[model samples]
Target: MFKNLKNDLPASIVVFFVALPLCLGISVASGAEPITGLIAGIVGGIIVGAASGSKIGVSGPAAGLAVIVATAIGNLGYENFLVAVVLAGVFQIILGVFKAGIIGYYFPSSVIKGMLTGIGIVIILKEIPYFFGIDKNPEGDFAFLQVDGENTLTELLKVINALISGNFDYGATIIAVIAMAILLLWGNVLSKKGKFFQLVQGPLVAVVIGIVYYFLTKDSGLELSKDHLVSVPIPDGLSGLKDLLTFPDFSALTNPKIYITAFTIGLVASLETLLCVEATDKLDPNKNVTPTNRELFAQGSGNIVSGLIGGLPVTQVIVRSSANIQSGGKSKASAVIHGFFLLISIVTIPTVLNLIPLSVLAAILFIVGYKLAKPSTFKAMYDSGWMQFVPFITTIVGIVFIDLLWGIGLGLAVGIFIVLYKSFGNSHFLHKEGENVDDGKIKMTLAEEVTFFNKASILKELDQLPENSFLELDVRKTRYLDNDIIEILEDFAFKARERNIDIKLISERGIIENPDSFIEFFKLKKPTE
Candidate 1:
């Protein structure tokens, strides 16, 4: 990993700028102290990044978990909630040990893509208001309906109304517009100039310019207040930083609600981490696969440490991961370095960080969001067929209209339904060679894998056979035949005898004549073997 520091160091710096604001925003949105988010970011980067098998995935406090964390904190109180988070980490470790990471494989590719796209749409929706200088909701709230009594679409409308009525903050709007322009130009042009330009990053430049703009407009009507800027808790000194950390309350372990909350956090965090691992692998230029089980273990460890030290739950977040990838991260070192940046920044220059505008960060996120949910992505998925497109579209709709988990659930349901439908129709193929039923010449070719899903179709075909029919049952191509199908064929053989039907079973082991039982005949050992 150290071999690629030339690339990794620069990528780490870019990810640091991207992660800093998000850490602060997510903490405030989660109903936790802002410092807690920074702690999670620090641990997720240094601990989880070092421990994780993934080379490119970046873990942090995710906007996806903001709702769950907020609700849990409100119910259990901060200290009690920290206990739940720690227990959740324990549960995740257990899951990793049991190899439950295999659950990640069960999700269809279409649904996964839909998830990325859905999250992109959510980010764009959530950030648009901020970009336009409308800041009613907190920065990291990414749900369809926010805790502030405004939904995604309604919030967009409110931004439009505010703009029309001239109630928006001009300082934020001007800075945000200029920052976005700088980012676009840097990405499209200046970044190509040299390694130095690439390493510096457009977002950092945008932020610096935004701060300067803020200072320049201090006494003007276009001035932005502290509320419109990044708000990391600034300590008076190194000693004051110690007061920000809050440990979990062990006494809450006896509460049943704590157990429920733990399970919820563990399940959600594991799922989010697994999905992120999959997406990150897709984004990796090297196409290296991350060990899903090991990732769970790493995240579990990070969360445990984070909780003990008063941090929100951590997961492999796609936003930060994507930023790392886009910034040319070559290894896990980039993620680890980003964490150190978070730690050092909070310890050293937090007061300076406070001067950065939220609008500048929103512009950066807008670019990230747009890239994830690009129009090209939709077109590509649509071209893949309805089998792929339906689940993909369903996931997007569900996520936009409902919540993240619900959207994924709905997409998975649709994907499963499609698989079942195809299975039912593809059980077997029937071919009739002879014209007359009296002659009774029929051939039934079984599918490569015949399952219980094909039971009804096979049974119906058997019942339709004419009396005194000659039937050929072909299983030469079959690799697996379900017990249900075997039983159906067995019962049909008995009925065939009563109808004076002659049966010949042809398989890989040659032919069976008047088999007493389909199961026994198929299971019989071959002489050559």
Candidate 2:
């Protein structure tokens, strides 16, 4: 892993710069202490990076889980939420052991795109209040409803009111605009100018500028207060640092809600990790495919360690992983090195870190959100046709109006329905050219895979055949013929005889003229067991 120090070492610094603001920003978004995000970043890098199969994939506190973490903390309390993170690690370990990493493949691409877009929209909405400097408990809940008797839309309304009344924080707003402008210019323009610009990310620059802005504008009307800046509790020494660490509340083990939150975190984290792993592998110059089950185990271990020390849930994050790859990372050593950087920064520069404006972080997240939900993405999905567009749109609306899980669930439900509907219509092919209209003969070829879902379509075709017809039932290409379908054919054989219809059954085994029963024919030699 350390063989490529010349390349990996430099790449690690770039990844560190990329991950720093994200860790802190996601923490604030998740309603957790800033230190918790840093802790998760540390564990995810050192522990998960060590255990992961991928040579370059980076792990950290993910923005995708910000909404869930925030809601969980609000509902279960931070201590109880820690218990969930621990249990979530256990669940992820179980999923890895059971080789359930393939679960990620079952989700339709449309649904996944929808999930990302929905989360992106929510992030933009939640961060707007902070961007405008109306920082009222910037816990960053993305849910439509909040515990403070206000919801996302209501809060947005308040921001509009603040704007109309000219009562917003001018200082924070100014910093945010500058920070955003820098991020935009750095990412879109400067980064293309040279390698130095690529190695030094926009978020880090925005954060440093925000700190400088805070110090320079102190005591002025445009000065941002502590509430508008990051709030990292400074530790005095070794003992003080240890005192800052929080442990899971074991008493919460008896609480069912803790288990529910754990399962949600585990499931969602696993999904996100698997998706990032796939994307990172694609981005790899060597095109290496990480062992997904091993990746799950590594993430599980990271989350366990992170939770034990008051950190948000950890997952393989695409942003950090992509930055690592683009910066010439050649091995996991880069990831481990980045973790040490995070640790050193917190230990040596807590005061400087605390000066970073929350508005600046909000601006960084604004770019993140925009990338996830680009207007072109929606247009492309719409162009993909209704099969893809329906579930995609459904998921976005569900996520915007409801919660993260509900949105994915609704999208999956719609996807499944669409699949079933198509399955029902495509049960078999009745060859037009093969039809002997003068003799009332029909040749029907069964689909490659016919399940019970195809029963209605197949039955309708069979019933519509003319009386005294010669039916040629072909199953040569059928790899899977469900028992339900066999039974349907068995029943139809009896009706065919009464209607004076002669049935010819063709299979890989042989051809049977007027088969007495399909159940007995295919039952003895099923195409696929």
Candidate 3:
């Protein structure tokens, strides 16, 4: 894991810069103490990262679960919620043991692309307001509709109004612009000039500049307030940090609601983890495929540890994982190191950490967002044809307007419909136009598997047979014919007689002349092996 220390160490710094605000913001959004999110990040990074088979995928408290976490906390109390989170970990471990992680492999590649693209768009949109210091919502809340009563679109509209009225923070906007400029220069030019630039990393530089700017502008008209900065809870010492940690209530074991909440958390967290593993694999430069079951087990163990210490539920989040990959992380060591950073920084230098401006982080995320949702990616998907493009576009729209899971569900539904439509048209093949011209003969070969969905197309073909025609029905290649299709053929046999059609049934069993009933014929002839 430490083999790529040069790469992983720098990348870990970038991920730490990216993850710190997210940890605090998601915790606040989830209605938990800010320290709880940090704990989850620590566990997810150190514990899950060490156990996970994925080299680049990063796990932490997820934005997708904010609503569930908040609701659980409100309904059951924080202590009971911690109990639910612990149970949720147990459930995830059970799922991993049962090999339920394979469920992620079934998602179409187009949908996965859509997921990455959609998240990129969300990150850009959500971070825009932060860049200008219009920070009403938490940084990690990625849902379309935010907890602040405004949707993503509406929030942008608010930002525009704030800009027009000159009601925004000039200090934050100035810092964000400078940070973005530094990132662009460092990434596009400076990083290529020498190894030192790559080793330092643009994000870490931007953050340092932002902190310096914060101190320089203090008490001035352009000064940024606490709302525009990273917020980590400061503790007196090791004992004070320990006092902040809350343990799960074992007394809640008898509560049925706790189990229900646990199930929900487990199911959602596992799904998110699996999806992330798939996406992360796609993002890997080496094209490494993570063992999904191992990822689930790692996530389960992380959640268990997190909950035991009063932390939020954890999932493999795309934002952090993508950031890690974009920052050139090469192994799990990066994730583990970032966890150590979070642990050490909050303990030793939290006040200084809080001095970093949120706008600068927003600037860093803007780059991450652009990388994921590049305009070229859209054109490439469009050129891939509708079978791929439709689902891909639909998922992006669904994610932008709805939530993550709902967007995937909508895309899956569209993809399935397209598959069925294609299947309906491809049920069987007819002989060449000029073949069997004598005797008005027509040959039809059934597909490998004919289901009820193909009944209409088959029926139409049979009804179009000319009077006095010779029909050669071929099932030599068919493996399974649905009862509906068999019934259709049986009904068509009676019509064939009226049309004076001579039917020749062909199968592995034998050929028959004018077979009486398709149902009986199929029953007598077993399907080919």
Better of 2 and 3 by TM-score: 3
RMSD of each: 13.8, 13.7, 14.0
Error of 1 at 161 (Å): 0.7
lDDT at residue 528 of model 3 (Cα atoms) = 19
Candidate 3 residue spans exceeding 4 A from truth: 424-529
lDDT of 3 by residue, 249-323 (tens): 899999999999999999998988887887887778765658888888999999999999989999998888999
Instruction: Please provide, for model 1 over 1-529, each residue's C-alpha lDDT reduced to its tens digit, 9 standing for 90 to 100.
Output: 6789988898898789888878877888788888899999999999999999999999999677888999999999999999999999999999999988867756666787899899888888888888877874567666677776778888889899999999888889999999999999999999999987887889889989999999999989889888888777777677887788999999998999999999999999999899788777767766666888999999999999999999999999988998889988999999999999998888789878889888898999888888789999999777556766899999999989888888889998997897676555563544444445556588878766665445445656787888887888877777655444565677677777888889998887899877898856754631111
TM-score of 1: 0.80
Consecutive 10-residue window with the lowest summed lDDT within model 1: 520-529
TM-score of each candidate? Answer: 0.80, 0.71, 0.80
| Deviation (Å) of 82 in candidate 3 | 0.9
Candidate 2 collision pairs: none
lDDT at position 324, candidate 1: 89
Top candidate, metric lDDT = 3
> Alpha-carbon error at 224 in model 3, in Å?
1.4
lDDT of each: 0.84, 0.80, 0.85
| Residue clash pairs of candidate 3 | none
